[model samples]
Target chain A: MKKLSFAALAGLLATPSAAFAQEAGGIDQAVNEVFAAVTGPFVNLIFAPLPGTSFPWIVLWLVVAASIFTLYFGFIQFRAFKHAIQLVKGDYSDPKDAGEVSHFQALATALSGTVGLGNIAGVAVAVGIGGPGATFWMILAGLLGMASKFTECTLGVKYRNEYPDGTVSGGPMYYISKGFIERKVPGGKIMAILFSIFCILGALGGGNMFQANQAHAQISGILGDYPGWITGVIFAGVVFAVIVGGIKSIARVTEKVVPFMGVLYVVAALVIIAANYQQIGWAFGQIFEGAFTGLGIAGGFVGALIQGFKRAAFSNEAGVGSAAIAHSAVRTKEPITEGFVSLLEPFIDTVVICTMTALVITISGQLMVDPATGNYLMDGNMIQTVGGTSGVALTSAAFASAFSWFPYVLAIAVVLFAFSTMISWSYYGLKAWTYLFGESKRAELTFKVVFCVFVVIGAAASLGPVIDFSDAAIFAMAVVNIAALYVLMPIVKKELNSYLSRLKSGEIKRFKG
Target chain B: MTTSIVVGLDGDGSGMRALDFAKKLAKGMGTCELILVYVIEWSPYSFQTAEENAVRHKRREEEIEAALERVVTPSVAALKKEGFSARGIVRHGDVADLLNTVAVEEGADQIVVARSSEGGFVKRVFGTATANLVMHATVPVTVVG
Candidate 1:
């Protein structure tokens, strides 16, 4: 089994990745190589041609998306921030809102979509590679991603499709494809179709499979001696049972789980951090220094910054089109309501949660063990695990150093965090599947089955290589999503300005359903 | 083919009301195998797993037994200490579907739950768990106000 995974990884990599890594051997070098294979060349061969060529070009496209939307919608993220709060406070819970969930429900749903392994495992990767510096960039990217989320979710509400049955379906796929068709863009139909295809694939890889795999890994780590496939089969069965029932089940679970787990993990991380109160100053010093000083195992300032940004971008997933699908299902007359609540996701995931992960690891004093200082030999260096394991266990070790009970507590936290995340992603991927493949029971079942299989794959295999590749796919979704949002920025801007006007006029009146 | 009536108990919001009503309904059903369920909202803070983060897969089964004893037994006992044949099931994810799943598992005829809604107008138009369940459930769900 190990041989097959390595071989499959080799075949996947021999195509483009291994050689690229040879050319660039910094900490992120291996990660970048895997990403290179996924973003354009490999995916294009399997599917269709992607729009951009270079990394900078990809960044440019996203900037264009933010700019066009900001100008067109008159900077909705800023204007709507205030009203978004009122909306979150329950100002617009009208059943006539043409969606299956309330605004808070939608925001919680979307948050469940974005806040997952990325925060925990993803942050671990950044800090492991970038040292403490990655936390800074991760926080910055999370804040900016808020605006992108605001723009995309606002678009989700405006362009949402209300079926005669009160079942609503919307996302980047709907807004980009359906909205473009209404506007009559040249080859807009093809663009929309292509975007839908990418979304479904992205959903399968990043949202569904990735979630199951990470959750399985966390569970296996905590329980010990369990069959990976058994976890997969049982998880699939449970997810199948929930998903087969559709969005209501998904909403019910996420609303409760997201808040509870989110608070739980944060408080636990804080507990560990607080115990090391004397080291707090040094921890920040190391993080800021590592950000610019190349203080990690990567051996360069730029490398640490890039890894941090990449992981943060991957973690919070603010710019990606995934959150839009979750937010799109919200029940609100106003699009901005869901968008405002959506802003909290990045703060929770990247700024707060991601920071906690970094601090716990850093404060645990396992990061940069200067054998010279004889302090503890970590130094942001990627220590190779003899057997395949990463993420929560590593965070666990850090906490255990400060608090004896942390190992067990952290393990339990990881499993639940991973479980809730995987279930939520299953919903996102299913929606994407339904969007592109036609809503058939077979399509849904097949996707669910494959997703379950991948969970086992994620658990059994070493996380580093495959997750590196999968992380790229998650970012690739951003490339496509930002492009669509750029073109549809006007719709987002218009929604923003209108909401601001309403807020200024005191029209929102009261808050609560 | 034992006739079973399953009632979902949530400790939060209007769940207390749901449990009380389900107990009354069970009494009326007479021969029904009453099943009481309580979902612990995911909290990093818990007395049971106080120092722990998640309910272990095995422990969840244990939690089902224990919660049945602790929360349900006393509550059920209060209904004139009904000496009815009853069991409990505990699930880990979302409340609405878990209740729906338990209903299907126990072959429940009716599901009773309390409505949790945030906004006033939205609550009326949507009616919380009742509205959501009606849209998605394969069985009739009677939500306690």
Candidate 2:
């Protein structure tokens, strides 16, 4: 059996390029065609362009939910921002809490999951298409997304099932199913099943494949072209080792690597930004102008708004319900405390880190813009580029303009970011898998093996439609998650009010200042 | 007639050496009990995010479990097998401070510790836990190398 399987694998590897030569179209194209044919309709439905515009309703769904959460909680993201910092600092934490991990580890793990290629490549894409004005909308979206993060994470902790072994199982699935029962709402079980299915798909696509694909891109871009299967196998092996050990192992690596990579990326941006201190005011001016007047792009204000909101939603994943799974594992008796801590995830991931990327790209002057018509120029071409010329290449070019050797560093950061993200998403996917298939050892092993296999497929295949389907699956989670949040916001409010009152009354003891 | 001696276990070979010395010393002192203390140095002051803090509880539990399974229980059981009265404890905090506190709380006549070989720059710069224990312990301290 082993010899046969090995022979089959060897044949598969050896034939890919030869097959490409013979077919003229290649395996990537064939796979993409098949994926598009099979999954394109559902992807289109989820990401259908709004009437009279290119923007998807899913973006609007996230934006609307975030805005409602921000208002419904009375702008708790702003009001509790200081306390959120303190909560992360463990000022109100007791070491005796019933959860598996600490608030800081949970936040770090979640941040590692969200703050990957999106912050680096996605920001560049948004700015390239939507212009400098997109930065303003992106920042606004990040601010509002914090409230959404707070709502979902609090529900994650409140409704989580703590097993006898002290491990926790939570997320939108738990909250949607259990929270509905508590509130006497209907069809929670069905919604939870739907959410679980989407979450698993999202974990495989965005969390696993997207990361592996991008990491391969960055690595190959630096090391010169090699078969992507090589990168896929190596990444899959490393990810399997870390993820198989469970959240603890993933957390250990992320806690260290996430901070290091975040600092490295931010400091590089800061150095470049500082070097262009003279252009700082001018950049902000462009951002404000482009945001309002549409920078002469066809979409104008609405276009910038859509790009900004879409990228921010995609980057920080505030309303997508993925981070809630990571945060739900935090050791806290008061579920509200985790909510306070989670609000900082979007702020750190989007507001702070992504904004830095945008500023660096803008200040570097890599993106050629025509002053008269407010259009980006590529060889005197009025480029109506959306996802084109955006991504790691753009970000790398922007950084390379400032520091010649920065592309190398950016490549390293991308790989690390991709790795940490994959590990975190592995846990997220596993939790959803267990939620569907009972939490047995065999079930867990099967899901993990499949997840690792997807890593290889992601790296090996040029799967545009697969990526689109996965991205759609990720946003699909937001649809169901936001619906549940709308129903459960009142419960979060009650927890918030009670926690605040007790906190104000000194009922919540401060363990350390 | 009863006396208690605090033995600080570092969960290493040297810690077993100190435990042997404490057992021998307790045998000389009539009706004495050896209090085996394993200190897991934990600082709550580091700047950490909520995600790091979430795992702190599990880590602390794991640390205690490891100390008991790999350090305290084995040492205590070995001494008890040799016919000495011994009890074990695992704690988290500043190693020296916690050791001193345990000595004072248990009414230990003296504190025994293995002399750590982590000297040179670390010793001159930060000072070893054994040195700090000897200097700050309320009761008399014996360093067994």
Candidate 3:
């Protein structure tokens, strides 16, 4: 049976390129075509426009939910923002009784997970297609999305399964099931199962595939056009080693390195912005004007809003329930504390870091603006730029315009970002996988192997379909997760109220300033 | 005047040398109260994965309980048996900060610690907790080598 399966695998790998050699780009092209076809319906269904409007319903779905959460919680994201900072500062932490993870560490881990290609490539896509107008909407979405993160993450910790050992299992899947049971709502199990399935798909698509695809794109942009499959193979090998081979040292190295890269990327962007200091006011004018009138861009203001919300959702993963999994690891007895801490994730991921990218892109003048129309010139659905590139390429071009050596640094940062994001998402997907298949070693190994395989496929495949599918899968998680949150929000409110009252009453002590 | 002295422990047996030194100082001063402090070196800025984060609180509880059982409680009892007033404190944070905080909280007039044998290249460059405490502590500090 093993030999037969091995032969089948060998045939599967060899036949694609051989059979489709005449097709442009061989196996990569073939795989992309097949994947696009398979994933098209789901993507369309998820992104399908509202009647007589170009705006996708899923973006509206997420935006509306975030707004509702903001209202429902009375803007806890703002009210508790200072306290959240304090928690992360370890001000409220018991020094003698520290948790396995400090609030700061949890926040940092979740930030690292969310702040990657989505900020780099995804923001470039948003600004490229939607113009600078998207940056305005992106910041708004990020602000509102904080409430969504707060709600989902609170539920995550509240409903997490603490085993006999110190380890835990939590996320949308757990909360969908356990929360419903607590609320006496039926179909919790079914919804949880569905959420898990979507989560796994999302992890494979956005978390692994999107990251690998962009990393390869950035590398190939620099190293010259080679088959993405080669890049895929190397990334998959390294990812497999870290996740499967128990090479925690690699994970540790990445954890340390990615943050440094993040700092460097920000610094480089700041340098560009600082160099173009006089254009700062003009950039703001363009953003505000473009946001309202769309500056004659396609879909105008709506187009800008859609792109902003979509990229923000994709970048921050706020309402998508992925941050819930990461935030659940925080060592706080009061689940609301983690919730408060989590609200900062979107603020940092989208509002701060993403805005930095957008500002640099805006200030760089890589995006061509129409002098007569006071609009951005569009070519084939993307802003007509110097090289007509999009995603990380556009970002690279923007940076390279300022400093020729920056792209080399960006390439390294992109790879590190991609690697760290993939590592984080693998864990998220694994939790969801174990939730569905049970926590057996075989079930886990199966999921990890499949995850690694998708890394190669993600790298090899073209960007459009991979991005479409990635967005669809991640938004699908939001659909299920937001529905669950709508029901479970009262619970979060109760936890929040209780925590606040205790703080007021001095029941919750501040251990440090 | 019932002088109080804070003695820092490294959680290992190495702290006994500092305790012995503080005891002699207390004997010379007369009517000195000893506060045994065991600090678990920690910094909030350190990175950890989700799995590591999950087990951290549990591990912390175990470390505190073990320190109390295997070190602090016994030493406190032994000091009391020797006709001296002694209490132990165990905490998780930056060693120097927490020790200084504990000393201030306990109204200690002196702080005493053994020279850390764990000194390496990094420690030498960054300075050890003993060095930090000696440099920054408001009270007198004694480093027993």
Candidate 4:
């Protein structure tokens, strides 16, 4: 009976793509059918259009939450930006502090998860659709998003459950339930459950599958069309090896890979931007002009605003709360210091990395502008669209214009980014899963195996709608997480004020000047 | 006269070599107590968020337990089996600093550690704990290769 059930499960999993692989069209159609059936209504509901406009309410939800946090914290993102850098530098870190990873390692781990294809492909899509003006909004959204990261991460560490074995289980579930109960809020437990459910789903979809899918896309773009399952199997194996060892192994890998890949990508972008130094002014002008004036696109200013805000929110993921999980594992008694360090994440990701990508794409002359209307031409006539562009391909074309060898470098970067993101998500998902199922070896293994399998499915299958649903699931996490954040902000404020006062009084000594 | 000798162990082959040397030295010294300490190189100065920091004590305890169980205890037992007086402890901190601290705290007459194979650029750039202890330790440090 066990064998029969296993075989049946195998067949069920394989039928969608494997059975129809002989006929690519049939497989794509079937995938689309199932995808549309499952994700269509769900996506519509989450990204429901704003009144009399095509802008997604979810995007507005994130924007407003970020704006509110910025105001409530008195723009702490800007005020504490310098201090955040110092925190990351370990200037005030005491060696006797109790923690697993350092603040820098925690930030690196979180940044790896956030700084993947979203910065590359997501930015390209935003720029392609919203024009250069989208970059301005993306930067603005990133700036505002820092405060959200600060609030959520602070609370994450404040209420985390440290096990007897010295391992930590934390994130929105712990914070929402614990923080709310402390404040005598009624729905804390239910909110925690809801957040956990969404977190697990988001981890599998956005964190695992989406990364696998994009890595496969980039590989095929370079290595010719081979089955995605091949990529999937390889990815699953590597991810399993790293994640099975738990956070230490994952942290060690991410701390190295994240920084290396980040620097490599940034240096390359800087080189391209510097080479086009003359056009730097022109690019900034186009960005500013398009940001407010909208380049006469169909949605105009609102459309650009939506795209820019959406990409930035998606890229930095301030209020989404996944970062809190990664940051919570930092070894510090003062949780507020982590909050300060986390604010740097969005800055480095969107403000620095994403901006570099935008500049490269803008200055590469890949985006064609109609001189008469002073608007971008989107009829697929630009050099970036040679192979029918949008997303990572467009970004690749932009870079390749400066260096012919850039496509190969980009392929490597994409794979490393995908690998780092998948492992980090595995931890996030496992924490949420354990929260619901009760933490045990069996439960952890179950989640890890299931996560690895999805990595394969993500690579092999052409389920666009499934990925869309997963993306929506990620935003759904933001909804629940931000609600909890609102209630928990007061606690965060108390911590922040106490920490700042301590700093002023020299109570928090600098171990290193 | 019970002479106390501090021996550092890293749970590696080199550490065992040092342990063997210390055991021989303690035997030659007639009546002696071998204070075996395994120091796990840990930096508390790294920046950590609250969650990782919360479990710091727990992890340190676990590290001490593992070091005692997997490394120090077995060695101490074997030494005792050989009719030598020995005790084991595990700690988390800089190896040289902790070794010196443990030596002084135990009131040991001398300290012994294996010469790490790590040399050349690594030794110059990031000096080994043995070299540091030899220079800075209050007690006499015996470098056993």
Number of the top candidate by DockQ? 3
**What is the full ranking by lDDT, best candidate first?**
3, 4, 2, 1
Query: Of 1 and 3, which scores higher on TM-score?
Result: 3
TM-score of each prediction: 0.65, 0.87, 0.89, 0.84
Kindly list the per-residue Cα lDDT of model 3 for residues A1-513, writing each as its tens digit: 334433433344444543433442554444456667777888999989999988888888888999999999999889999999999998998764553588889888888788888888889999998889999999999999999999999998889888775677889899999889999999999999988888898888789988898888888878899877688889999999888897778888888998888888888888999999999999999899989988767888988988998888778887899989988877778999999999999998899899999999999898898899777888877788878878888898899999999889988998998888898889889999999999878998999998998887777656467668776888899899999999899998889889999999999999879
Residue A151 displacement in candidate 2 (angstroms): 0.7
lDDT of each: 0.62, 0.83, 0.85, 0.83
Model 1's lDDT to the true fold? Answer: 0.62
User: Where is model 1 chain A poorest over a 10-residue stretch in terms of lDDT?
Assistant: A93-102
User: What residue runs in model 4 are displaced by over 4 Å at the alpha carbon?
Assistant: A1-12, A15-20, A23-31, A244-255, A296-298, A371-374, A380-388, B1-60, B69-114, B119-145
Model 4 lDDT per residue over A1-513, tens place:
334433433443566555536654455556567567766887889989898988888888888999999999999998998888888777877755523467776887688788899998889988888888889999999999999999999998999988766778789999999999899898999988998888898888899988999899889988899888889888888777766644455445545666677898899999999998999999999899889998765477777888899999999988999999888877788999999999999999999999898889889877776779767766642223445677888899998988899889888888888887887788888889999999888998999999988898788776677678888888999999999999989999999899999999999898776
State the displacement of the C-alpha of residue A345, model 1, in Å, after optimal TM-score superposition. Answer: 1.6
lDDT per residue, candidate 3, B36-58, as tens digits?
98877777788766655665767
lDDT of 3 at B23: 94
The digit string of per-residue lDDT tens for model 2 on A247-322 reads 4554465557667878988999999999999999999988899889876755778878988999899999988999
Task: Sort the predicted structures by DockQ, highest score first.
Answer: 3, 2, 4, 1
Model 3: residues with Cα > 4 Å off, grouped in runs: A1-39, A225-230, A440-442, A460-470, B1-5, B11-20, B26-36, B61-90, B106-109, B117-125
Per-residue error for B14 in candidate 2, Å, reads 1.7
User: Which one is best on lDDT?
Assistant: 3
TM-score of 1: 0.65
Error of 1 at B102 (Å): 34
**Candidate 2 docking: what grade?**
acceptable
Local error of candidate 4 at residue A61 (angstroms): 0.9
Docking quality class, candidate 1? incorrect
